[model samples]
Target: MSKPPLIFAVVVVIIAVLATQRYMQKRRQDAVNDASPVRTLQAEVSAKREFPAPNRRSRQREVIAAEEMRYEVYFRPLSGGAEMMFALPEKTYHDMDKGMRGELSVQGTRFVDFRPDAAK
Candidate 1:
């Protein structure tokens, strides 16, 4: 009944609503990706990078935080289109190098696979 308790309840409710919205959005995106047809494109690995995943923990604890690392690979389609950036598994990310030409399989915003050309 007090103002502090009321404020706290409001904050908790807001957080819960936001979390639910985010979860629903993720589900919707998964469905869209599932329905999307995989497209293979001749693309070159343009770049790659790693960044610390978002975390609320302190900097010292970030070293031990779950999902502390996130990796992304950029591909430039040789046929001419805006380059696409995809979040990929660490192993796959490491397997690609800038300027390596290959077939890039993609489903909507999801990354299917990248096979680098063996000859060049």
Candidate 2:
């Protein structure tokens, strides 16, 4: 009924809608990836990144909670192509490094596997 509450409600609804849309879009992408043929190509690990989970803060700004870390690996096709980044499990992410050349298996935008070249 009040302006503050009304504004809060609108903001919450907007956030919910955006979150739902993102979830649905991700589901659609997963389905598309599932239908795509897995392709293994020569590529190199061009970069790697890790995002540490943010700590939740209370009204007093004290840390309240923390989340799991997220990791992504970037690849560039050896033959030349646009680079792609994919989220990877922690262990696998840790095992990879920049400039490692090898086979990269992918389906659609999903990362399947990366096997570094034995010589490298």
Candidate 3:
């Protein structure tokens, strides 16, 4: 083939390869995003209260900073050392104290199915 035709073929091949790569990358990202869970578990280490008996319960009071807003996080550990964090949108850190109670739930993290307390 002539030099011009050979060069044009090479350019077309390169363009095709680049386009395919980009498409594949986008597809992979979309698949990951779709498979990921809506919420994930986060790791936190601090002093907390625990309830040893069935009727009696303890609380862990701490301050949390979220998006320029400060709130209090309270957690009460159950029988098996499992604890749940709780906070209200209208409550501040200073408002929390002993004798307060609430219910909370834990969630998994990332696209992979793992426990809530998995090490980050």
TM per model? Answer: 0.83, 0.76, 0.31
lDDT by residue (tens digit), candidate 3, 54-104: 222324344333323333354544334454454334333344344443322
Candidate 2 vs candidate 3: which has greater TM-score? 2
Comparing 1 and 2 by TM-score, which wins?
A: 1
- The local distance difference test score of each candidate is 0.89, 0.87, 0.44
Candidate 1, residues 1-120: lDDT per residue as tens digits? 646778899999999999999999999999999999999999999999988876765555345546668899999999999999998888988888888999999999899999988883
What is residue 59's positional error in candidate 3, in angstroms? 61
How many clashes show up per model?
0, 0, 0
Give the per-residue lDDT digits (tens) of candidate 2, residues 11-83: 9999999999999999999999999999999999999988764546423433334546779889999899999
Which segments of candidate 1 are over 4 A away from where they belong? 1-4, 60-68
Residue 65 lDDT in candidate 3: 35
Predicted model with the maximum lDDT: 1
Error of 1 at 72 (Å): 1.1
For model 3, the stretches where C-alpha displacement exceeds 4 angstroms are 1-4, 40-120
